[model samples]
Target: MSENARVTKAAGVVGAATFLSRIFGFVRDVVIAWFFGAGLSSDAFFVAFRIPNLLRRLFAEGSLSIAFIPVFTEYLTHHGKEEAFHLARSAMRLLSIILVITAVLGVLLAPLIILMIAPGFTDSPEKYSLTVLLTRIMFPYIFFICLVALCMGILNVLGHFAAPALAPVCLNIAIIFSAFFISPYMADPVTGLAIGVLIGGALQLTLQLPFLIRKGFYFWEKAVIFHPGVKKIGILMLPAIFGASVYQLNILVGTLLASLLPEGSVSYLYYADRLVQFPLGIFAIATATAVLPSLSRQAAAKDFDALGNTFAHAMKLVFFITVPSMAGLI
Candidate 1:
């Protein structure tokens, strides 16, 4: 098949898988709404959820994947799969260390972090305390979700799109179950959601492991920080993190600013952003996921012409799909 056709087909599979995941996500949100609604616990949970989620986008799937995939592809192309796996293992170790440290700091300083992000919460001690408590419960999610991103990056680069794209459904399923079943037994219902977030994150990562191992991917016993591939990924990820995490940062800054608005503003924007994210989660990510593997191949083969065409094709698809969808949502 032609390159364009191949990319389109791959993207279709990813888009479908992502669509299913989003449906489950929406169901999870509805379950939350049914139990929590737009109130103190809900708002607190939104803040709690957004913190780790922002980091997930920043370091895991968003910028990290963009930077990691190309460098990974480069390694895979010239060095072969074994060497590429070596690079992946080393990169995973470095990423895990950073995420674990950040997650720990986030948990330890949850109250302070909440104060900084949503200072207005201070006016209501109840909300403020709840946010901190939930943040502590959920902060470790950053580590798991980021690890999921790393695994997804490897799968995507290996041309296994469905596994990464579909993995999110596990998260949605876990949360749905937590909301319906686990929350009743918890001290606070929102705590159940927090527990679900942790479970979902781990599940997302674990679901991909067997498939990855079958493909010969394995974790490195120790992190090789000075590995050339690790260095290259770090160099690329620094700037790319800023670029890739733009959406998450935008919403986060917006959320912080919302603290100055009337109460419930944070939750309103949180839900609104989720609505926008639905389509983006579907088409934009699908396009990116499919393009990255093919684009990496073209670039690896020094086929700039094919690379340019692939990039253009992806942009065209994204624009054509997103413009109308965003307009309709608005």
Candidate 2:
């Protein structure tokens, strides 16, 4: 096939798979609404769940993937694949250590964080306690999800996009099953959903292991977070953190405003935003997933012309679709 033909074919596959995943995800949400409905628990869980989910996007997928993958890919392309592998190992260690510490801290501070995020929860001891417990269970999800993102970065660099795109379906499937069969048996639906969240993350991470092993990048050794390449990741991540913080703060402001409106304000926003999210998730992410490694390749060769060309093409593609979609939403 010609280069354009190959690229087009690859994109079609990714887009098709992404569409299926989103369809399943929509079904899962529909099931959740049928089971949970719009109520205090649903509202609280959605808001509470939003916190970690937002962080997962910002830290795992958005910031970390965008920043870390480019650097990691650069190492792989230029310094030799072994050096790139070393960077991965080092990142694994650093991420493990940091996530462990942060998850623990998050668990410990879950009540405080919940209280601060939604002060209304404090008035109901039952809701407050349950939210704290659920948050604690789900906080470790960031670690799994972020590690999955790292694996995805590796896969992306290797010209593999389908597996990473498909990984999320596991989570949605797990939640859907749990919500239907297992949730009623649990203490409550919210508890079941939280458990499903954790299990889904495990499933997501596990799906990547076989692929990584096949690629000879599945060894389990501790990363020296201070390793040279990992340090570069850290350096890039600083700005990434600030950028994510600003974005999250904007969402927080929106949430706060939504909270002031009425009982279902947050829930309405959640559903509405989910629709907005669906296309962006499929298009932007699939494009980014497919293109990052290519751009990294050009960067590795210090071929700014190629990089610029790819960037322009990708931007045009993103804008052409996203602008009209946004206009539709407006």
Candidate 3:
């Protein structure tokens, strides 16, 4: 097959997987609506959940994927596979250390973060307590999901897209199951949901293990944190984070504004935000994921012409699809 055809095939695969994940995500949301309904408890839990999700997008999925894949892929392209693996191991070690620290800080400071993000919850002690509990339970998700992102970045760098793309489905399935079966047995439904998140993240991480083993990346060992490639990724991550974090910040702003409204307002925003995420999940995200490693490889090879072409074509395809999607959403 021609290079273009090969690229097209990979794009198609990611597109299909993204579509399935989004579909399942919608189903998962529908289940939440049915089980939780729109209430203060649900509203508070959603608000709490939103905090880490915002960070997840800003860091784990958006920034981390964009930054890590390129650097990781560049190593694979220029330095070869072993060098790439070393880079990944180094990056993973750095990521694990940083995320552990962040998660610890998050646990210690969940109250302050909650106070800032959902001040309205302060008025209701019961709801406030519940939200705090849920936030603490769910906040560690950032750590697990970021590690998942590392594994995924490595997978993408290796041209292993399907399992990485499919990981989100496990989270969706976990939520759906929790809502249907676990919630009924639990004293508090939202607690079940929160527990499901930790479970889902674990499961998501688990799904990547076989892939890692298959790729001979399963052994756990440390890599030097100060490696040049790792340092480059750390540097690039900031701007890439800035570029992608705006939408999530927008959601947080919406949530903050919505918090001032009636009881179900936060929940309303949550569900609407999920709807918006569905198209984004498929189009922009899939395109970005499929293109980035390729772009990185091209960049590493100093093939700027190919890099520019790949980016332009990907941007064009995104516009071709996302324009109509935005219009339809409107």
Off by over 4 Å in 2: 1-10, 221-225
For each candidate in turn, the TM-score is 0.96, 0.93, 0.95
lDDT of each residue in 1-330, candidate 2, tens digit only:
532333445565677778888998999889888887766666767777777787887888767887878888888777887788878888887888888898889888987888777666665677667768778878888888999999988887877777888988988998898897788998766788888888999999999989887787845754456888777777887888788788788777776566555565667777777898888877776676777777777887888886787777776777877888788888
Error of 2 at 161 (Å): 0.7
Report residue 22 deviation for candidate 3 (angstroms).
Answer: 1.1
Off by over 4 Å in 1: 220-223
Which residue pairs of candidate 2 clash?
A: 90-223
lDDT of each: 0.87, 0.78, 0.83
- CA error at residue 18 for candidate 2, angstroms: 2.1
Q: Evaluated with lDDT, which candidate comes out highest?
A: 1
> What is the per-residue lDDT of model 3 for residues 1-330, given as tens digits with 9 covering 90 to 100?
644555666777888998998999889888888877788778878988887787888888878888888788777777788888888888888888888898888878888887888887787778778888888888898888998988988888787889989999999999888887787788877888988888898899999989998998844755677789888888888997988778777777887777777788888888887888788879888888888788778887888988888888888878999999999999
Deviation in angstroms for 91 in model 3? 1.3
Give the per-residue Cα lDDT of candidate 3 at 197.
Answer: 85
What is the TM-score of candidate 2?
0.93
